[model samples]
Target: MLDQLRQIADGLGQTLAPFCEVVVHDLLEPDQAILAIHNSLSGRQVGDPATELGMARIADPDFTQVLANYANQFADGRQAKSTSIGIKDASGRYIAALCLNLDLTLFRGLQSAMNQFMRMDTEGPRESLDPAGGADAIRARIDAFAGRHATTPRALRTDERRALLSELRAAGLLDVRRAMETIAAHLGVSRASVYSYAR
Candidate 1:
């Protein structure tokens, strides 16, 4: 049952690859941390944090906060909306759990469309990330960028912003172009708007 759930999540991740990333974790042993799968729009595989380059070691002090998040949210699947249907053996003793890390922003639109078309909420219960918080993060990043480069009205040009965004991606401040899109979406504007600001 656990394996089946993982496969299902993997398929969903692939299907939704165009707009977001999906991550799966096993909750039976929260610390075990199996990254069942992740798919990205930029065709980048989500690497295990432990093995990924430049990522702070999972064993670092900051790992405690990560663990706390896992225990508080990931383990329960309540805030995460990942679902924790028990994985049990034939005898019914609990074994493990399955989690789905869905991108709420993108999925919500598809879900609404499906609900409208089906005339029902086939979209199950959803726990979504704080889109507002994400937006604020982008604003903060923009402020930081402005501070770094002496931003002024003159700096806010389309081509300049695009170049800044491109530079940020190259510098690893942003991992993929989708990150730019996310920031743009959060700004309640087009990617072009964010690109202009980036200048």
Candidate 2:
């Protein structure tokens, strides 16, 4: 059954070739698990030792299958995205492992180009002090404060509300008379309740 699976592994390697390196490991022989390999991106040979994933399967019967993508670097320092899967026998024992390592250098270069192409000017506009916009700014600040405390603005405790008001006052947001009204409306509290928080 394991030998039959080797052809599938080889086919996968060829299909994903150039970028992908695929290897088959025989778990019974930890010292030389590499039974077959394709693409050979890692430069590992048929007689190479089992990887950490194979060793884990050997140590733990429950490690039947492991499919994870992780960062890996080749001996030549080239970065790769690797996925390893452990195959098991009928009795729940891991018998073989298959691994696919994908070179990420080309994708990373494309990502850099995409970022440059999609770049935008972040300093396009400055904020305005219009009453409606000011109210939005005040609500945004309160929401940010609530987020820091892991709660919603309406769910803030009295002490938390007091601290939030203190921060707002220190930021000069409460200097405008309508700012308190805006905060009170946003918090579902009365203007007097908002004022008490300032103390």
Maximum-lDDT candidate: 2
Q: Least accurate stretch of 10 residues (summed lDDT) in model 2?
A: 126-135
Clash count, predicted structure 1: 1
Clashing pairs in 2: none
Whole-model alpha-carbon lDDT for candidate 2: 0.88
Score candidate 1 by TM-score against the native.
0.28
lDDT, candidate 2, 1-199, per-residue tens = 7787799888998899888999899999999999999999888999899988789989998764767788889989999988888887888888888889999988899999999999977889865666555777788999999999999999999999999999998988997659989999889999999989997
TM-score for every candidate vs. truth? 0.28, 0.58
Candidate 2 matches the true fold with a TM-score of 0.58
Candidate 1 off by > 4 Å: 1-5, 18-24, 27-29, 40-82, 106-199
lDDT on C-alpha atoms for all candidate structures: 0.48, 0.88
Candidate 2 error regions (>4 Å): 121-199
**Candidate 1 lDDT for residue 30:** 44
